[model samples]
Target: MISPTLIQAKGLRKGYGQRTVVDGLNLDIREGEVLAIIGPNGAGKSTTLDLLLGLRRPDAGTITYWTTDPSPHVGLQLQSTPFFAGFTAIENLRMFAAFYGKRLKDAQLMEHLHRCGLEEFAKTDALRLSGGQQKRLAIAMTLVHSPKLLFLDEPTAALDPRARRDIRELIRSLADKGTSIVFTSHDMEEVHKLASRLVLIRDGRIIASGSPEELLSQYGTASLEQLYIQLTDEPA
Candidate 1:
């Protein structure tokens, strides 16, 4: 039996006036897997996430979250970690969790804090948290609603080795729990470690896609980084 698609983007097209970002792209992310979109800078990774989240309409395509439930679920972590500066760590979570229209009491909030290793710092003001702490906070907040589909944009772009590993582990745990993930990352090491499948894009179109080992073998490369460079260098 075939499992249902969690998200499908058909002929996705987006642009800022004359400069088109994504051109005739189509992709699908299914339940219980991690699909990482990796490409060169300005390759339209963020734009694709925006369209997929329904934050913006595609100029000529359909982006749908395929669920019978009226309010099909999704959670997003945009390029930056957003939180109210004056609010404490737990406070920040409270605000966003409320926006999700879900009631997460203090006990549950503390549980997430403990899971994120932020229980000691729960009372600290969000603005005062370090960059790694902030990123962890973002991940914890995104998990507040226990969404079916998660969109993460460059989640570890600016973090030390330890923090990066922690976030990647968190993602792995979530995927194991059956939450579909669509993440974009410049860190090939993290991508190779976290993604069940890789979707490579160049100039807004998918140029190559497969498992990390498959793509590496196919492109005669030792790493996903090398495969990415080779693929994006070729003209489609």
Candidate 2:
């Protein structure tokens, strides 16, 4: 069965000076599903995410969450996650958990690290870790509070193939456990592998949206890459 809607946005519009970024967008983030928002650069994908996350106010729109206080149940992992200078990987997880007002035992903390494949780097300074390790650590930090809804921006960008595969598996596991994930990515293969549904946007408007198979069939395209190219190509 489909899960309940965890967040709803209607007619979201945001702009800077004379330029609009997110224009007349509507979205629904339901529980226990993975939703990917994809688009070319400058297509307002990130702006749409910010509007839905409430990090930026829209010029016109309304956003509603399942609960009145959604922060306790939400997690956000931006592309760049800054860790405290001296905190180790495990320490960062503890600190983030405390931000949500929860204290985790060592076993619990280790479990989070283990899941993200960071247990070996538990005591390593977060900043000292390699780029991919830091990325995984950031994801671990988001899970410390066991949030019901997670927003990941470019979760697997720039990682080596193995790291990317690991992160994909992690996302799949999270969805299996019923966490609603909203992520943005340029990797169509990752999108095809992970997204139960997706929204494709351009110039701040949705151009196409549906499950991978659904959109592919609707457009009569062989794959998502082909569909993306077809829909996003400039008109002659």
TM-scores for every candidate against the unseen true structure: 0.94, 0.96
**Best candidate (score: lDDT):** 2
Q: Model 2: per-residue lDDT, tens digit, 110-214? A: 999999888999999999999999999999989988889999999998788988899899999999998999999999988999999999999898888899999
lDDT of 1 by residue, 1-236 (tens): 44678878999999999999999999988888799999989999899988887778899998776765513378788878768979999999989898889789999999988777788889999989988788888888888999888889888878788878778888898999998888999888889999988999888999888878888888899888877777777766
lDDT of 2: 0.91
So what's the TM-score on candidate 1? 0.94
**Backbone atom clashes (below 3 Å) for every candidate:** 0, 0
Q: Which pairs of residues have clashing backbones in candidate 2?
A: none
- Write down the RMSD of all candidates, one decimal each: 1.7, 1.3
Q: Which prediction has the highest TM-score against the true structure?
A: 2
